[model samples]
Target: MTNDRGTSSRRIFAGIAGGFLVSTVMTTPASAQDDPQHGLADIIVTAQRTEGRLQDTPVSVALLSGEELATRGISDPAALQGSLPAVQFQPVGDVLANIRGIGTFNLQPGADAAIAYNVDDIYIAHATGLTPVFFDLARIEALRGPQGTLYGRNTNAGAINIITNRPRLGRLSAAAQVQAGNYDLIATEAMLNLPLGETVAVRISGATQKHDGYMRDGHNDADIYAGRIRLLFAPDQGTELLLTGEYSNQSGLGAGGSSPCLATFAVAGCNRKGWDAYAGNETPVPDDFRSVENIGINGQLAHDFTWATLTAIASWRRVDYASLTTTGDANIPFGDFGYKPSNANQLFTGEVRLNSLASSPVQWVVGAYYSREKMTNRIDRTFLSDTLLGVSEVLDRYRATSRALFGQVTVPLGSRIRLTGGLRFTDEEKSASGVATNYFVVPAASIATGGAESHSGLTWKAGIEADLARASLAYASVSTGFKSGGVNQTPAGFGIPSSYAPERITAYQAGVKNRFLDNKLQVNAEVFYYRYTGFQELLNIFAPGYLAFYTVNSQKARVYGGEIEVVAMPSPDDRFEASLALLDTRFTRFDLTSFGGADYSGNELRNAPPVTANVAYQHRFRLGSAGELTPRIETVISDKYYTDAINSVAGQQASYTQTSASLRYLSANGGWSLTGWVRNLENEAVIYSYFGGRGYPLAPRTYGVTLRFETR
Candidate 1:
C-alpha cells in the first residue's frame, strides 16, 4: 500500500478550515448564538500510570472510551480486532493481538504473548485469562510500539492497558445493564460503589455473557462470568491503600477444526473443503474449561515536603488458570477418538516505585520490578482401531523469571519546549523440559524423557520527546524490543526444535499531535521505522517421510508505518472520528537451507496487511422535556493481505470491509438507557488466517440490544 499520509495533510487542513468558516458564521447570527455550541471534550487516559489528558502524553497511544466500546459491542478483547487502525488481532483460536505488524503466534501452553495485557497495573499472564468479560471500565489504552520501560516483560510488541473505574468515596452509586442479541446471546453487567467508614470505600463489578455458536456442532459457543471487588482506605491526608480481587470462569466448546481443501481454486464460501467441513465433525471434549483467579493489593503513601512530594507504591499479584481441549487428525474421517490435552499456568509479580512530582522544570521517576511465571502441560493421544490400540503422552513444562530497573526524566526547557528521556534494563531467564511416552501392543512400551534447556538475555530501551506548543508536539525515540526463545513442541512426525534465537527489533519513530479550529477538531499523526534482526520465521521444511514446520532466525526485515487520527465535533450533539494507517513491511534478507532446498530470501512477511483504516460517527439529539437519543455508526476497512510469506499464488484473501452501528436512548434523569447495535452489517465473507492447510473464516454478522439503569 502507498504511504500517502502527507498527501492527506491538505485534506485535513481543509476540514479544519471549513469548520472554522462555519463557526465564524454561526456566532454572528442571533439564533446561532442561542443554539448550543459544538466542541471537543477532553480525553483522559492512564497511559503513563498517572491519569492525564491524552493530548499531553508524549507516548503514541490510541484511546477507546467506554462509550465507544459499548457502541461497538466490544465485551471482549477479541472484538477489538480492526477497531483501531494500528491494531490487528489474528483470530486463530484465541485472539492474538498485533501492534504495528508484530505479534506472537502461539496460544499453546508454556508460551508467552509478545503483547502484554495490564489491567489496573496488574499483569494478565495468560492469553485465555484476557478473554474474560469487560465491564465498568474507565478506558482502554493501546500504546503502540515497545513499552518495555514501564510495562515490564513480554512487551516485545506493545502493551494494552485497561483502566477500570476506581472506588468512589462519600458516595453511593450503582449501575446495571442487560444485553440480548442474535443467536441466543445474552449478557448482563452490574457495578456498585459504596462508602463504609470515614476513610474506607469499596466498589464491586460483575458480568455474565453467553452466546450460541456461529458454526455447526455448537462449536464457538461462549459462556463467560467474571467479577471484581476493589477496596480503598485513606487513613491520612497523604496516604492511601487499595486492594482488589477478581475471578473469571469460562466454559464452552473451543474452535472447530478445519478441513483440508480438496481443490486449490475453490471460490469464496465454497464448503467442499476448509474449516467448514470439520465444523460438525468434532464433539464436545469434556474438561474443556478455562478459569482464572487473581488477587492483588497495592498501597500508595505520599509525604509532602517543601521541595517535592515523596510517593511509594508496593503491589503483588498472582494468577492461576487451567484449560483442556481435544486434538483431531488431519483430513481422514476416523471415528471421533483423538488426543485430549490439558494445561495450567501460574504467575506472580511485584513492583515498587518512587517518583518526584514538583512544580519545578524537572521531573523524574525510578522503579524496580520482579515477576515469575510457570506453566505445565500434558497431552495424551488414545487411538482405537479395529486391530490395535495405542496410547501416546507428552508433558511439557516451562518457567520464566524476570527483573528490571527503570527510570525516566522530563525537563521543560522553556514555555514552548520540553525534553524527556527514559531507560530500562531487564534480565530475563527461561527454561523448558519435555517427556514423551508411547505404549502399543506387542507386549512392549517405550518411554523417552528429556532434560530442560535454559536461556537468558538482557535488554534495554532509550527514548526522547519534545513539546513544541500547547497544540502541537513532536517526539523521536529509539526503542528496543525482545521476544524470548523456546523449544518447539510439535512431535517429530511434524517438526523438531532447531534452537531458534531470540527475536529483536530496534524501532525509531517521530510524531506530531495538533489541534485546530479552536479545539473543535484534533489531529494526531506518527511515523515509525523499524530494523529487525534475528527475526523468527516459521518455515515448512520437508524431511524424509515427514513434513516439519520449525522456527528459524533467518531473516532481516524493515517496517515503516504511520497512523493519523482526527476527532471532530461540528455541533454539541454531533461527533466524528476517523483514522488511517499505512504500513510498508518486507523481509530485507531471508536465507534458509534445509535438505529440500538451499535458501529463500527477500520473501514478503506472511499475514502482514499493508493498509488499514477506521472511521466512526455519532450524534446525540435532545427530546425537549423528555430525554436524549444517540446514534453511532462505524466502518473498518483493510487492504488485501497474504496468509503466507511466499505470497502464495492463490491463497490470498482479497481486501474486505466490516461495519457496525448502534443507537441508544437515555432518560432525561440519566438513570436509564436503551441501546441497540449491529455488527458486521455487510456480512462480508472475511478470512483472518489459515490453519492446518485450510482457511478459517471470520465470524458472521451479529446483532444485539442492551438496557441500562443507573443511580447515584
Candidate 2:
C-alpha cells in the first residue's frame, strides 16, 4: 500500500511541475511589517528545518503574524481556529486540542492528541499545559496536511509551530499596558530587554490576567486567574543561544449543571424544574477549585559555519494539575456527586540539526530527535453527603519513549523554480497500566489491566514549486503522517481490546499563493485529499449495568477539503481579511463485528464541520503627536457538526455565528498599550460539544480589558 501510494504521488508531483513554466516577472512585493489590508507579505516559516519564504517551500502552510493574532484576541490554541479555515480547535480540557476535527475524545491521563504541537521545535506532550498565553513572538506556522517528514510521530492531522522573539544584542527596550472592563476584569503585561555586555543579552517578560466569569454561581461568585513568564539569553556573534521558561495557573468553578426531568413531567422545549434553580430559587453551591502548575525549560544553540549552521535544542517540561467536577447525569434527578482527578506529567526532548544556506543550490538539512515522557493520574469519586465519603478510586500510569531521524533537501531548478523532498523514520514504545477499586461496593472488588505496544514507520514527502511571478506561486506535494496506538481499558463485556494498532494517513495537496494590487491584496487557496488506513477512532460503548464509557478503534476512511484566505489593505491604516473552508469526510470501510453485524461505511466523521468561515476589519488612527488608537471587529461562523460518528441527528451542534470587537490605545513610542474587548457579542447560546446523553454549553458573552508594556 505504501509503495503504491508513493508511486501515485510522484506522478502527480511530476505532472503539476511539468505543466507550468516558471515566470520571472515581478508581480507584487509584500513585507511582513505591513497590515493585512496592505497585501500578503512574504511568509517566512520553519516548515522545513529552517526559515524560508512560504511561497518557495513546497508544502501546504498557513502563516499568522503576532499582530494578526492580537487583532482576533487569540491568546490560546482553542481560539486560534478562527484564523485557519482548514483547522478546527475544540477545547475538551487544558491539554486536549483537536485539529482538523480529529483528536482524542476523552481527556483521560494516558490519551494522546491526534495533532502534535511544537514550540520553538520542542514538542509538548501534555494537553492540559498547552493553553494560550500571549507573549512576544515572531510568527505562527500551521503546516496543513501531514507533517510526518519534518515533525515526525503523532502528526496525523498536522502541526502548529510557535516561534518566539529571541534576545537582541546591544539593545534596550521596555513597554507596559493595563485594561479594565465589564465583569470587573483586569489584565496587565510587561516586558524588558537589556544587554548585559558586548556579547551577552537578557530578555524577561511576564503577564497576569484575571476575570470574573460570565456564569452566575448559585454559591459564592468565582473568578479565573492565569499568569506566565519568559526569559531569554544570547551571547556572542558567531554563536547565538536562547532559553525560554513559562508557567500558568488557573482555579475556577465548572459551568452550571442541569438536572434530568421526570419522564411524566418532561416538556418538549420548556425548561425543567432544576434547570432554572440557579437563576431563581437558591444561592449557588460552593464553587469548586481547579489548580494547575506548569514549568518548562528550553534552550537553543546555533553556530555559524560560513556555508552551513549547526543548531541544537534541548527542553524539559513538567505539569501538575487537580480538578473537581460534578458528574450527575444532566437529565436525571440523582444527587450531586463529585469526581476529583489529579495528574502529573514530565517530558524531556532533544534535537540536533545542520542547515545549508540558501546561497547554495542544494539547500539541505539533517536532524535527529529524542523524547521521553512519564505520566501519572489519580481519580477519586466521592458522594456529596454530610460525611463526604469516598466511593471509588482509579489510578493510571503511562510511559513513552520515541526517537527519529529526518532529513530534507531543496534544489533550485533555476531562479523561478525549486524541488524539495524529505523523509523521516520514527520508532516509539508505550506502556500503560490502570487499576480501579470500588470500596463502596458489596465486597470491595478491584480490577487491574496493563498493556505495552511498539511501532515503527517511515514517512516521506516530495514537492515542486513554480514562481509564476514575484507576487504569485503554485505548488504540489505528497506527504504521509502517523498516530501511535495504545491500550483500551473498558470492561470485559465491551470487547474492547487491551491494545490497538497505529493509524496512518497518505495525503496529496496542491495550492496557489498570490499577492496583487501593489501588495494591497493577498490570496491563498489549497485543495487536499487524504486516504487514512487503520484509523484509530474512539467508540463510546456504554456498559449495560455500569455507567461507564469505553473507546476503541474503527477502520479505514477518506477526507478531502479546500481552503481559501484573502487579506486586503485599502489603506495603510485600514485592513480587511477573510477565510473559508469546505470539507467532506467519510468512513469508507468500517466493520463493527465485535458488537454486531453493523457497517459504518459512508458515515460522516464525528465532530467534523462541513463549512467554516471568518471575517474581520480593523482601522488604526493617530490620536495626537504621541498617541494612536486601533479598533477591530471580527466574526466567525460554522455549519452544523456531529459530535459522534454514528451520524446521529440528535448529537449535533446547530450552526452558529459569533462576533467580537476590540479597541486599543498605544503610546507613540510603542512601548505601552491599553485595550478593551468583548466576545460573543450576540450572546448566542452556542454549544461547544455534545455527546452520549449530555451537552457542554459554550462560553457566554464575556467582556474584559487588558494593559501591556514591552521593551526591545
Candidate 3:
C-alpha cells in the first residue's frame, strides 16, 4: 500500500473510489418456399408513437417477447446485458447504463441516466428508479441511438421501453411458475386474468425471489417482491381506457470487491482478495442490508375521431433506495471508506398524442409532454478515524420540471423511398439545496450549497428509408439529443462553482434490415458516429487528509460503433441467432481547470467494450408418448473494458467469456413445462466491475430447475 499524502485541493482525483457504475427477438413473414417450415412470426412494435411492423421501422431496436423472458429467466434489468449487443448494466451502487459508449459515469445527486427508461410511453424520472420487474410482460425494446426528438431529456444514448400485457375483455386465464437453483435460490411467479360483465376486464400478477449469497463472505445475495394490477374498460365503440398500479421491493446484501493490484488501488492493512476467494476479512461486518421500494400508478385513454386518434397517458411514481457497503482499506486512518446512502424520488408525468387517421401522402404524429420530479439524498460517509477527515455528512434536495412539444411526419416518395422528419422543443428548470458539515469547519453550523438553473433546447431528427429487394430496407438518419445540467453537493464549501454543465450529442447512423431464404432468415446491421460536448464524470478527490465526492465536466469526446444481428429458423424445430457490437471511443479533449495540468485525451470511455458478441442455438425434438424436448446453449464474449476515467488497469475488467445452457420438456397441450438451466457453465471468475479497490466478479456457475403451469 502506497501512503504518500497528496494535496487535497486539486479538482481531479482518481486514486480510489466507490461502487460500480454503468437483448431480444424478431418476427417477420414467410415466403412461398417457407411454407414447409414454421415462419418467423411477424412482430409488432411501438418504436414510433404508432404500432407498426418491426422490420419496417427506420430506427434500430431490439425486442424480447414474453415467451423469451419466461424461457431464459431474464426477470431483471441486470440480466439484460448478455442478451443485447452494446447494452450494459453493471457496477452495483449506481446501477450505471451504457449504450454505444454513451452513459453517465457520475451518480451524484441530480445526475440523470443518459439512456432513459420508459414504461408504456410514460418516462421514468431517475436512473435509480424502479427498473420495472419483468412478469406478464408483452415485450421489452431497446431503441438504439439518439431519440431526443420524441423521448425528451436524458435520452442522449437511447431509451428502454417496457410494455405489459393488457387485459382481454372476453378471456379468462391463469399461469404460475416456480424455480429452485444453487445457492439456495428460490423463486415464484403467478398471474390471473378475469372478465367482468361485457365491457371490463382485470389482470393481476405477482413475483418473489430469494437466494443465498454465492460467497462464503456473505455478500451478493438477493430478496425481491413485486406485484401489479390492471383494469381495462371499453364502454363504447370509439373509446377505451386502462388503469394500472404496481409495486416492487428489494432487500439484499450488496456486492463485494477485490483489489486486482494490491499496490495501486489498495491501502495499508488491506490484503488483496482474488475472485475465487472473496472475503470481508477487514470489511465492516454485519453491514447494513441494502433495500429498495417503488410504487407507481399509470393510466391510458384513447379515442377515435374522423380526423385523428387521440391517446393520453398519465403516470406517478415514488422510489426509495438505501445501501450500506464496504469501500476502501481498513487501516488508513480515514480510509475505511464504508458509507451509508439513502435516496427518495417522486415523479409525475403526462403526455398526449394525436395521430392522423385519414390516409394521405403525409402521415403525422404530434404530442405534448410534461413531467416533474422531486428528489432527496442523504450520504453519511464513515471514517475509521474522524480526526483524519473531520466530517461525514451530506443532505441534499433537488427538483426538476420539464415541458415539451414534438411532432413528426412521413411522406412516401412513389414506392421505393420515404422521407421523414421530426422536431421537439424542450424547456427544463432545476433547483437544488444541500448542506455539508465537517469537523474541520470552525463554526457549529453546516456549510450550505445549492442554486437554481434552467436550460432549453431544440432537438430534431431527419431520415430517409429506401425499400430494397426481397422485403429489405436501407435507412439513413441524423439526430441530436440533450441532457440538462445539475448542481453538486460537495465538501469543498460553497465558494466553488458547485454545478456542472449540460451535455449534448449529435449522431449520424445508417442501417439495413433484410429477410432472405424464403423469410426464414433475418439480418440487421447498423453503423453510427457520435460527437459529444460537456461530458460529465465523477472525481474522487482527497485534499490533504480529507475526501469528498464531486461531479466534473470534460470538453469533448468522439465515439463510433456498429452492430450486426442475425436470426435463422432452419426448420420448425431449430433456431440459431447471433449479435455482435463493435465500438471505438476516445476523449477528443479533456483538460479540467481544477486538476492542475493533467490531460486525459485519447482515453477510452468507461464501461464501453471495444468488441462484444453473443451466439445462441436451440433445438426441439418430439418425444414419443411424452411431449417435446428442447436443448439450448449460449455464449457471450467481450473485450477488456475500463471502469474509471483515467483508464487504469487496476480498475479494469479483463476480457472473458460466459457460457450457459438449458433443457426443457413440455406437455402436448403446451400448458405445462419443465426446464433445467445452468449459467456461467465454465465457472470462470470473470470480473465485470470494481469499486473502492474491490472487484465485482460475475456470479459463479448456477444451475436451476423450473416448473410452470398455465390455463386458457
| Candidate that would win on TM-score | 3
Better of 2 and 3 by lDDT: 3
Give per-residue CA lDDT, model 2, range 84-186, as digits (tens). Answer: 6566655454534455566666645666667778887788875665634555667788777777877887787887788866666678877565555565656
Kindly report which residue stretches of model 2 are placed more than 4 angstroms away from their true locations once superposed: 1-40, 217-235, 254-287, 328-338, 381-393, 491-493, 595-599, 622-626, 669-671, 710-712
lDDT, model 2, position 190: 59
Give lDDT tens digits, candidate 3, residues 1-712: 0112113201111111100000112323335565434757678988887888888888889888987777776666666657777787664543556888788766476777888788777888665565435688899888899898878888888988888888889899999999888889888889999999789999999988888866555666778889999999999888999999999888876544343233344431122344333444344357657888999999999998878899999999999988876544563434676567788889999999999874655779999999999988887665655454455555566899999999998888988789989999999988888887665445634667677779888999999998775467788999998777887777453234577777888999988787777877888878788999988777665555456776666789888767878898988888999887777778899876454535787788888877788899999999867889999999999876776787765666666788888889999888999999888887766555554555566567888888899993
lDDT for model 3 comes to 0.75
- Best-to-worst order by lDDT is 3, 2, 1
Q: Using Cα atoms with residue i matched to residue i, what is each candidate's TM-score against the true structure? A: 0.86, 0.86, 0.91
lDDT of 1 by residue, 1-712 (tens): 2346334433543444454334323331122222224566668786666556777777789878887776567787767776777888665556677787777665445556668888776676656656367799888888988776677556766888888888988899999988899979899999999999788899999999898866554555678888888888878776667777777777676443343332355553323323353353344445444444444555555555566555555555544544444434344233223444566666777776666654656777778887787777765554444643444445466787777788777777767566666777777766666655444435645444333334444455555555554465666777777766655544443334535567777878766666656667777777777888877656554333223345666568887777777888777888989887776677787765443443546555665666677899998999976999998999988867666555553445677789989999888998898889888898765555544354555667889988889893
Q: Lowest lDDT 10-mer window, candidate 2?
A: 268-277
Top of the candidates by lDDT: 3
How many steric overlaps are in each model, in order? 2, 25, 13
lDDT of 1 at 288: 47
